[model samples]
Target: MPDQTTNAEKLDRDAVADRLTDLTEELRAGENVTVSVGNKDMVLTPPETVGYKIDVIKKQSRFRGNHETVRIEIDWKPR
Candidate 1:
């Protein structure tokens, strides 16, 4: 079976930026990155290069109004 950990929450722009900044720093440091997902801690070791993807979605609804979502994904195989 495949193991996966996922976490999602509404965070302010600065908080989100801080999280991203930390992740970027860890990746640049060329070491395993420790991340918290929900209540669990996950350690990831990304290779020198990895797959990157970005997606943008816009939605409109009469009752829900309109919103845009930007999704970014980075993945790599562990050695």
Candidate 2:
């Protein structure tokens, strides 16, 4: 039989690294103004102007045979 695993399943490290890189770029560019995780929300204060913000949310694991998933949401406003 041949291997049926996907790159996503075999290497999840890149996904996180990619996210961090994207966030860093956004912050550095001042394109992201706010970030929200779960019920908590943080706004970028003055001198920290962000025109856009991306939010990544992951649900808590529940039950066996369940697969982990991620949801990404972006919030932006005109400067």
Candidate 3:
């Protein structure tokens, strides 16, 4: 099976933006991106090119209300 790590949490807009900014900085510097969730950390090095994908989903229901979700994925092979 493929190795997988997952972290899920609810944060304010600013917090979310901050996390993205940190990741962007690392990528821009061509350094390994350090992903930390609680106490676990995973280091990943992305090559010059990577696969990027984004998905946006919207759901509407009379009783449950409306909700929207955005998912972003970035992946690359190991050197």
Could you tally the backbone clashes for each prediction?
0, 5, 0
**Local accuracy of candidate 1 as per-residue lDDT tens digits, 1-79:** 9789988899999999999998889899998988778799899988899999999999999999999999999999984
TM-score of every candidate: 0.89, 0.33, 0.90
Report how far off residue 35 is in candidate 3 (Å): 1.3
Q: Model 3, which residues run further than 4 Å from truth?
A: none
| Evaluation by TM-score, superior candidate among 1 and 3 | 3
Candidate 2 CA-lDDT value: 0.50
Candidate 2 clashing pairs, residues 3+ apart or interchain: 31-51, 31-52, 32-50, 32-52, 33-50
Any idea how many clashes model 3 has? 0
Residue 66, model 2: Cα distance from true site in angstroms? 1.1
As for candidate 3, its clashing pairs are none
Q: In model 1, what lDDT does residue 73 have?
A: 94
Among all windows of ten consecutive residues in candidate 3, which has the lowest summed lDDT?
30-39
Q: Which ten residues in a row have the lowest lDDT in candidate 2?
A: 2-11
lDDT-sorted candidate list, best first: 1, 3, 2
Q: Point to the candidate with the largest lDDT.
A: 1
